[model samples]
Target: MKKYIGILGLLTVAVIWGTGFVATAVALDNYTPFQILAIRFTVAFLILLGMNITKIKTISKKSFKRGSLLGVFLFLAFAFQTVGLQFTTPSKNAFLTAVNVIIVPFLGFLIFKKKVPIKGVVGSFVTLIGIALLSLTSSLGGINLGDMLTLVCAVFFALQIFVTDFFVDEEETWVLMLLQMGSAAALSWLTIFITGEGLPSIKMETVFPVLYLGIASTLIAYFLQTASQKYTTSSQAAVILSTEAFFGMLGSVLLLGEKVSINMLIGSIFIFIGILIVELDIPQFAKKQG
Candidate 1:
């Protein structure tokens, strides 16, 4: 029951994030990337604060520290991604960001001495290939400054997932969720000031989508992710969450009226296969020498 809940929760997170791509596209029309980040995180943090106000004073220093660490990674991941998008194709940015799915297993092994699972390892690569097919409209262009920044962004995202899995066991989920959001919100606001993006005027069209992003994408999706990781390994979480790309593709086709090519369908199948490889325990047929 717990296992199914964990996977289902993570799937919900992926779906929310996938839909967020559409909201973000609409929001980008009226706001700078930093502005979007600031608004979304601030909105999420404030709501969380409202929900936890009675217990605010009860949060411990240790909880605050862990949340702060996660916040830093979370903020950095988005920051670099937003900036990286400027110099690279959105396709590249999207594909590179998905690289975190591949990093989680290796990071676990190297940093925590956790044994890597063979199927999970294979699954991640297959998923990456699928992402490449889905995201790259053409051949991958030469690497550039933006590509490097996006890769760094991927590393930070991987850390966020890895650390969240580790810290979920140590801290109250709500406390961790609220503080990390607050920390990310604070950093996002600072970035706006640093970049001198003085208040971008808003309109009804943009406001609605931004609000959706704040509530659904940041608040709900992240809250679910943090909670779900409690019942699953980070590797499984990473692979499941990579389904965000698959969902994003679906959203684009349905919402944005993008046409699906043959490769796209093939890619989606590979993604499904990859997910099965990670989630299902396949029988090994190799004979052992007695």
Candidate 2:
């Protein structure tokens, strides 16, 4: 039951994050990327801080330092994605950013000296092929500025996942979440000033999306993700979270009227299959060991 609940929570996170891509695209029309991030992170941080105030006070200095490092990685992940959206279509951005799933295992192997499973290597190749199919469009032909930035975002996101996995202790989930969100908010606001972009007037349309992005995507989804990870293994969690790309594509089509081509459908299937292969293979390997 706990595992099922965790799975459900992860699916919810994927859906919320998927819709967030559309919301972000809409918000971008009115405000710059940094401005949107600033508002979203600020609201999310405040909410998390309120929820974890007592825990925040109890966090040790070492825990606080680790959490701060996680926060920096989180900030860079979001900042890169937000900025990359400016240069690419949201659908493309979504698929490219999802490449972090492929990057994560490699990062773990490199940084933590973990051994890479053969399943992971095969999954990576399959996912790369899917990315090629998904990204090949008539207008774009090959990679563009937006795609490059989104790819960079994928790298940061992979690092964030690895950092979170390393630093998240049994005692400090809520406190760490609050600190990370607050740090991201601070960094985003600083970037806004550094870029010389002043705060823009907020309209009703923009305000609603920003609120949803902050509360739903940044706060609620993140909370769910942390909770779910407690019940699910990290490999399973990664597989579940990879569905965010599928949700993003759906949201783009439904909300933004983005066209879906035959190639996209085929490519999406490959991506799904790749993730399924990884998901099934890892658990089976674990069962064999047991």
Candidate 3:
């Protein structure tokens, strides 16, 4: 069914993004965070533009508006996350950013008047705990400016997901994707200028990782997401998409030769449990049993 396809597509996206952790580690060795963001979006835009050149004639004003709005949210989410990392530990930044899983369902209710599913609410909490276990290091620290910015980043990411769900069916998927990337690329370059972040040297070491992130993470993963959201509710999609953290941990082990801890194993178990709770509509089963 389409729902299963959507779930599969989103899982694929999560896997690709999880692998992005490794690519990002390599890319960040040479490039500033903003520089990586700029190049990644720019390369994604160029590739998407090339692929969708003939389809450009079909783009409409409404579609462009919607796509551009998504681009704004996408850029803000990345921008905030990058800046937030400067002040917060990577663990806290990652955990705070994952809070978008909880925000998406509420955002839908508040803005669109959609009825939220009970399973999604429960799954989100479980997933939050899972992410906490996975990403949190050392003692829980006091909240700070970086934490607030990362939380804002989470909100923008939730917006990006909901908006993509809203407009994917209304516009040409490929063209919608193209405009979104093009808009983000423009914003990223502007941010680079404002921050005075210079571009990294063009070298095999940096370019390859950036190219992988652009082509695999931005271009392909987002196209899959935009297409997949049409077949699933945003709440369900959010839960599924969050498996990226688990996959990121997996990538760290396999690709980076890091050892997994018991905490991580437990965290991965809870994450999959959360995914199954959302995917299977477990609350409905509970009601039937009662």
User: Across residues 1-290, which tens digit of lDDT does each residue of candidate 2 receive?
Assistant: 99899899988998899899999999998888888889998998998777766766588887777767767888898888989899877777887787877787777788779987777777888987787787767665676678778888888877776666655445356776787788888898889888889875778856988999999998888878776777776666677787888889889999899998887788777777777666575776667556
Instruction: Look at candidate 2 and give me any clashing residue pairs.
Output: none
The lowest-lDDT stretch of 10 consecutive residues in candidate 2 is 163-172
For candidate 2, what is the lDDT? 0.80
Q: Give the winner by TM-score.
A: 2
- Candidates in order, TM-scores: namely 0.85, 0.90, 0.83
Over the stretch 1-290, how does candidate 3's per-residue lDDT look in tens digits? 99999999999998887787667666767887778888888899998888878888888888889889999999999888767666654444544565677788788789879766777667777866776675555667545667678779989988999888888777878877888988998998887788887755788755998899889999999999999999998877887887776676667667767667676567666756766665575657569546
lDDT of each: 0.80, 0.80, 0.78
- Return the lDDT, model 2, position 205: 58
lDDT tens digits, residue span 1-290, model 1: 99899999999998888777666666776888888888888899999999989999999998899999999999999888877756654434555566787788779789879776777678777977775565565667534777678778989998999999989988888899899999998998888888798876777766888888889989999999999999999878988887786676667667867676776677667666766766676765112111
Candidate 3 error regions (>4 Å): 83-97, 115-151, 258-280, 283-290
Which candidate wins on lDDT? 2
Alpha carbon lDDT at 195, candidate 3: 80
- The 10-residue segment of model 3 with minimum total lDDT is 87-96
Quote the positional error of residue 228 for candidate 3 in Å: 2.1
The predictions' CA RMSDs to the true structure, in order, are 3.2, 2.8, 3.3
